[model samples]
Target: MPRGGPVPEFDTIVIGAGMSGATAARLLADAGQRVVVLEARDRVGGRMHTDRAAGFSVDLGASWIHGIRDSRLWELAQALDVPTIEFTVGSFQAGGRPIADFDGAGNRMSAAESARWVADVATADRALEEAISRSAPGDTYLDVTERALDALERREDALDPERIDEIREFFRHRVEEQCGAWIGDLDAHGLDEDAIDGDEVVFPQGYDELPQRIAAELDVRLEQVVRRIARAADGVRVETDRGVFTAAQAVVTVPLGVLKAGAIAFEPSLPAEVADPIARLGMGVFNKVFLQFPERFWEDGVYAIRALGEPGEHWHSWYDVSAISGLPTLLTFAAGPFGRHVQTLTDDEAAADAVAALRRLYGAAVPDPVARWITRWGEDPFSHGSYSHVAAGASHHDHDALAGPVDGVLHFAGEATWGEEPATVGGAYASGARAAERVLGRPVDLAAFAEGIRRSEV
Candidate 1:
């Protein structure tokens, strides 16, 4: 952790101290391998950032831990004694009307609907896995992604002949809104399983605390900007704006955006197998504009506001974090294209828009925020983007390709690279533990690692 000393390289080095990188560092360190985590940002918790300057804490990056019971982060939080607040699901207000009250129905899954959706996703997942296996010896991720989606569509009718068009359109729209692509900005004749498939979790206390808890005992150098990674037969040399450090093996856990932008150059350029996946995998920009009000303005308890008024407008969905409790913070989400557009606006502009939207729904009880924070993951050189999502015609296999080791010296870990739960904090933790197991001789069952992870910390 020293700033100035002999370049101390290790058996492995993990880059980017986000959930993925931090988890990998913990597992490796626990395994007793000398490890170093190179973080580009001044602070820890890559995307899990929380701003508590105001009376209430606002998450600048990730705010929720989706799927708590099965989440490794949940166990980590319990081990660290971090507070856990139940995630409340209520009405989603859109178009000046409540869409549906999801409090009781939030966790509801229709028998037919669940079966159909699951089957569809499973077929797509299988097709993508096949495509990855059949990819040309060194095909780029973009090439593989295209083929993967094509393969899914080729077999689409078999999955659901009656709902072919519906399923295709369903996947397409999902890719636009959820896959990090701006809605309606893109068109795809083929379907993307990776983009359409996956589940989500929410964190009541915010996702940032999970990482801070995990990094509590580690030696982390804050405000460090990694510039380059030099790999040699002897060891790897890592150059950062803060200082240079060396480790036997380096786990590069930085965001895919940084990897794609060539923010941290390698002594030798990465191969297509390594570099292409980073490029092909999309680093989505999911920004949240948190606005604090003096009083609860709306009659509805805690609800989600979905803005679908104009043809092209941002602020798609807003949620009252205090739905469970009586907090005054209203958190809203805009991803893909909308998030990018909002990023160009000023904080005041963004805050004003949120307030205006509230006034439209709740009258005038909600005044301008006493404090506001806008998440700029896309603009952060270290993060480059929010979380990674598979684009149209892309597959999760692209992330799998990135997960493979490069020269056994440069290891990668992060949420983007996770095959399952790529966007969750638990996925990052699992990826980190997997990387550590690889560095050490220990083997872990991919399915039950979280339970074990929790047990280890507990």
Candidate 2:
């Protein structure tokens, strides 16, 4: 019913033109398969959008390649000859005053501070793993897991087993730094540990350039939001707001949230196992608030400032875009539950709150911004959130459930479905490649790619 015109046909149909779908479509098309990509938005790069209306480019979606050291996206940049700039994560200074390095005192955490956090993270991960391992691996997985985690909090190996609840509280606060704070409850626990690669890069020209360059020669139909998929014994029927399309195989690369939200429905309904993963895998909200001031206020030359707030508080971190290039832009990051709440505020309200937060740390010299831009991936219909991460007690196997194809025809690929590094752009690319490989009936070089992904963690 969402279809408007005649139903064209194809060998493969990929939905959502973000990194995952784009990669999947390109590979499939290059492999001599006729593919049609359906996107709800008017443009491609669903969450990797960059706006250049202002003098400089601002990423309305993904700003950085995240961690660049071993990133597949970084490798793609090299292959495509795309230029990039480094984004430094440095110390915190406000209003010409050294508030302190990264500490709970509302300053950028120092190397020591980061190491402390890392240790706590390692402890938390282990605690979760031990909880799962201790549980009997049968029908009572959900119940046993809950009990194990509750018991693990009392173990002496914990960061603060004596204060188990407080330890989980602190772990939640720190995970906000690693993943978006708005992530849902634990769906799958420890499959593997994917860390941030030492190298991280940002495109001075813009991240948007990469997708456009890769898609320049492809036949992309803009503004076609898919609404349904009717799979018959003969072929797969795809419906969208633009038109109807039919294909032998369909690779659905839309965000986890889109599937969970039921933006697109299936005729007979996809198997519960397939649909359940979407419901279980949570999408995280990471908001970036950018502002341009008349002049630079802090001179620490630090790339990032971590404002350690009380547990469960938002606006605890800020990035000095100026530090990277001495530009007039100031960008701040908010993740986790606090970030979800932040998505509900108006841009003006969000900016006003951020200004107040900065003023508290930086004094009055940092006046109101001349121009303000806020990225709210949470509320977007196409991508309900920015990226994906595991909840406590959830393992990588849960994600593998999403990876399983339906009738060897319907494939799922996205950052959320990646097992090694589930949230990065490189993970999305790798996931797409894996999905393509699945459709072609080939064994993926998981070991090689796993090394590459791990090498590029951020």
Candidate 3:
């Protein structure tokens, strides 16, 4: 038995303490509203964690500050004087052979081969567009990609089965890497969504610094797992493992995966409009296995190495962190179903697989990795999965529905809720600011924070 205490009250309670929640709380607090942030994790940065290892700041979650042109994160980095560097894809390999290097154009091949590949890719792209346009409501991106590959094979008789399989596997990995879900699970129509234009950049200091800076002055409670949200006539009550807190409004910025898990119960259940989209949208896993080597034995100047594996192999792609971090480190990614599969393996097993794959590419004498770190986003209770994606039957409108406020008492903001820029840090930040504007009843000027970004680039 414990003594009773008065429930803490605030104008708004922001949940999750990630980018979106921090942004919303900061905005609300800046406007002089009594706001509090509840984070389930022990730290403030939810999906953005920077672990220091082997003399490097390794981003364990959410590494890239993508889309530098319009990226709020880039802008914030500039303002905060956080160091960042341009991340460019350098070399690519398939089936233990150097395939090509990354040019502005997406393919690497000889002049003649490049020309043929480009033409074939264009033809396949057009066929895919047509297929998607004519596809039934339940059609998936895998269906479109497969249809396009079939057309490509038929049109190009010179393409042998091996070459066709290579192309198919290449595109499959590309789709999985870009969308964070297997093509079979992605919505074909949603594949048409435009990406934000900009160069990709990485934070050398740590990606978590962005959220940390944004949360510097806000009232954030960590290690508080929000269990239930009850909206009443007077206000909204948020029940957490720690205690109960009341607020005039609440912002739920938990990841879509967590939402899908129904981790937090809503009293007077969420409306069908809100709940339906949650069911329709898909959560994806993109896990990374970082290995630190005693020496840099791999080829220099290469940024990315794509191992030509089966469509859904965990060792499909590996990033050369030495090129950027100057630390003898190799980062491997396993996305979609493969990522989940990798999560099931033990740390040593995953590390050994990564080393074996590297040896296959770099020769048998390649030294073993001295230190290793693996990410299992699927196993993380806080995140559940890596990010959000549009499922086979869902569209961008479902993102809108997931984002929409309910009864003016509850607001939702996260990467999943971002319509145009889902699964990006910028999208998550934008969504948080938008939710704050909703609560404030006025548009907030977040551009000022991003001014340094433009200036720094210039």
Best by lDDT: 3
Residue pairs in steric clash, candidate 3? Answer: none
The CA lDDT of each predicted structure is 0.62, 0.67, 0.78
- Model 1 CA lDDT for position 251: 81
What does candidate 3's lDDT look like per residue over 332-395, in tens digits?
A: 7888888888888999998998787666556765798888889999889998998888898998
Q: What is the TM-score of each candidate against the true structure?
A: 0.74, 0.79, 0.89
Predicted candidate 2, C-alpha RMSD: 6.7
> Which runs of model 1 end up more than 4 angstroms from their true locations?
1-8, 88-177, 184-205, 308-312, 323-325, 363-366, 444-458
lDDT of each residue in 1-458, candidate 1, tens digit only: 22354556566767778887777777666656676666767778888887766544567776556556555666666655666665432211011223211111122234455455446655655664576567653344345445655666576355434334333333433454444564333223112332312223454456676666556566777777888888765567888887878876778888778887888888878878877878666677777777767766654643454332231134445666764235676777667766788889899988887677555544555676766778777788777787776654456677767876776767787777777767656667778777777767577543353344455565
Quickly count the clashes in candidate 1: 20
Question: Please, what are the lDDT tens digits per residue for candidate 2 over residues 324-355?
Answer: 33467878776766777778898899999888
Reference-based lDDT, residue 164, model 3: 64
Order of models, best TM-score first = 3, 2, 1
lDDT of 1: 0.62
**Local error of candidate 2 at 68, Å?**
3.6
Which regions of candidate 2 deviate over 4 angstroms? 1-8, 88-170, 182-184, 187-192, 310-312, 323-326, 392-394, 442-458
